[model samples]
Target chain A: MKRRLLLVSNSTLHGEGYLQHCQQHIRDFFGEKVTRILFIPYALHDRDAYAKTARQKFQSLGYELDSIHEAPNPVDAVRKAQGIFIGGGNTFRLLKTLYDHNLVSEIKKRVLEDGVPYMGSSAGTNVSTVSICTTNDMPIVCPPTLTAIGLVPFNINPHYLDTDPNSRHMGETREQRIMQYHEEPDTPSVLGLREGSVLLVEGNKATLLGTTNACLFIRGKPATQHEPGADFSFLLTDTN
Target chain B: MKRRLLLVSNSTLHGEGYLQHCQQHIRDFFGEKVTRILFIPYALHDRDAYAKTARQKFQSLGYELDSIHEAPNPVDAVRKAQGIFIGGGNTFRLLKTLYDHNLVSEIKKRVLEDGVPYMGSSAGTNVSTVSICTTNDMPIVCPPTLTAIGLVPFNINPHYLDTDPNSRHMGETREQRIMQYHEEPDTPSVLGLREGSVLLVEGNKATLLGTTNACLFIRGKPATQHEPGADFSFLLTDTN
Candidate 1:
């Protein structure tokens, strides 16, 4: 079976309710096929509270959500999950937890071989890519490695923002950070997803969806932008 | 001999020339006893250009700065240097280069045991701490470990910014990031150094210096703000 993923830039937009803007897209992506989702709330500290919020949201969208933290056997939970949803928080913490529970390979097997539907928001989106090198989160915790699920051919930088020319902050901008990643040898391409942006992938076809355009970055080349309805299928096959 | 360090939050302030904002502090930290300084320009991509920028700045301050990358023997140069300066860039790239060149322990010994004066800006400041877990830079590359020089007992979050109430960005604020760091077990205290802020440590004495205030985040405790002249000496020995 082919891989399927819905990578969201953020959980909520400014002044919007949680997942409100992307509710329709979420519904359409999961459809009637997935009546339940295995939620991974490891990115956040308060697992109970994080799960509660996500459970309510998914419930309202006509799906049952079960947090992996509450599971007696997380690997078994992934194996039985019809869908997987990873929430946003600190990427390091989430990835570390996944390793601690030995769920990386199990989840990968389910998503890749069984084609279990997968959806990730922010830190969640980050872990589905080649590596978590492009995440904007602090490395609050250290994982054994920077490797991720490799659900996508390239890395995903969620919550990507454009440089504010008038601002005086001296830190590297989002684009500059991605540029630095490109400097490393054999680094894969990176997709910069702006607020309210989502990338939907089904088999070999990938589409950019939501309110904003996505920035595609390749090594030795300037970054290019894609519109909401743009086809990103080429990204799945292009290794260079 | 006392461990001497000047950890700056940034290399340059808004609308200022390189190191112009902290030139006086650099002078006071090095003093007349230190005539030449060894420069580590590994944080950035262009070693030659980074070295030139640092060399000229240190020269204007009456110190001869030699780029370690250009030295015949990098570790030997570190052993002979009166002062060490690590310029700011991507923290991951900087730490990886240090490990690749086998300079971590060498520099740590020169500063902690030999009492050689150490100055770091941005990425440099992040690496001088216990770990790079609190840095704001993207993880563009992977180092062997997030372990740093441990010159101080705590982590340093350089270029830390306060949340803007007017902004709508949903990403975690600098305080939130450090808070997450505090959530990790056995994690050290984190100092959030705003742009134009500097942390000066001479032996057991650590002081907050420069134009901005520094925020201290201790586990399970509310973060406290310190003024420019505030003494942070307790941070040198406090493990809790």
Candidate 2:
């Protein structure tokens, strides 16, 4: 069995409903086989509320959503889960919760070893990378370590924005921040996925899916913009 | 001895030279009696170049700036330093470097116990607080911990900006991010220091200094706006 993952840049675009933009993709990716999804709502502040909202959305798509937080044994839940869905919120809080529950390894086993379908958005998408080092969210809490799921070879910077040339903000731009990340020799290549963008990976192959182009950050090189539907599988082979 | 600190929100304002906006404040904070100052340039990607540029700026201000990276013993340098200046780049990098060199405690002792005049801008200002929990910079590197110098009682969110009402960006506003931070019970009140603003501390007293108003975020309460000359000493006493 090959590993399958759908990593989205954001849950919703500007003025869009929760998971509205990616509903069709969600359906197409899972097909008619995946009926139940083990929903990880740890990224959100209100887990119950987040789970309820996600349940409504997933059910409307003709699927059952079971929140991992409500499970008696989260690790066992992952082991038994056919599909996994991680929502977006605060990356630090999400990663910390995952570590606290000791679900990191179990989720990896289910996704990488058992070949269960894995899907994540925003903070969820960020944790699937080599580390949470590229996340844009505030570090409200310190996780045991920055090391994450490493489901993908490269890091994903979700909701990646282009620099506003006319803006007066003095803070480092998104590109400049990624450049700084590359400054550390140990850091891997980063994919700056624009809003509405999704990276679909199956086995060793990955493809960019969306209307807009995604920015790729290679160490010591200029960022290259890849059009939607471009084959990004090359990134999967260039591991740190 | 009373602790003295001048924490500027940013190193440079738009169209301003390096340390240009806060040069007078820097000079006033460290009187003419303090000529030689130890500089921490670890926040930046290029430490040597950052140190050289900072040296020229400090020289123009009639002071000799020595980078801690060049010191044979960084801990000893901090112990003997009359004044300390930390420049801005990335808060995570700054805090990690401080921990790597084991200089956090030494610098805290010099500034809090010995009353050495301490000044920092942007990322530097963020680390002077209880933790680097409210920084706007990307998490380019994972430090051993999020714990910082704890020189100030409350956390500082430097280069804080007001939300642009007309913008189409769907990302969380600065205020919203801080609110998410407060959702965590252990999180402290955040001071949203706008660009060009500075927070001055002497002993137990703290004052907001600059042309613009600063925003204060208290858990379970509405964010309050404080004028430039407002007394913020109360925040100094509300330690986590």
Candidates' C-alpha lDDT: 0.92, 0.91
Chain A superposition TM-score, candidate 1 = 0.98
List ranges where model 2 is wrong by over 4 Å: none
In the predicted model 2, the residue pairs found to clash are none
Docking category of candidate 2: high
lDDT per residue as tens, model 2, B141-170: 888889899898789999899999997777
Give candidate 1's chain B TM-score: 0.98
Candidate 1 lDDT tens digits, A140-193: 778999999888878999999999999899999999999988888889889899
The candidates' DockQ values read 0.88, 0.81
* Cα distance off (Å), candidate 2, residue A55: 1.0
Q: Considering chain A alone, what is the TM-score of candidate 2? A: 0.98
lDDT string for model 1 (B40-115, tens) is 9998999999999998988999999889999999889998989999999999999999999889999999998999
What is the Cα-based lDDT of residue A69 in candidate 2?
94
Instruction: Give per-residue CA lDDT, model 2, range A24-114, as digits (tens).
Output: 9999988899999999999988999999999999999999999999999999899899899999999999999999999898888889998
For candidate 2, report its TM-score: 0.99
Estimated TM-score for each candidate: 0.98, 0.99
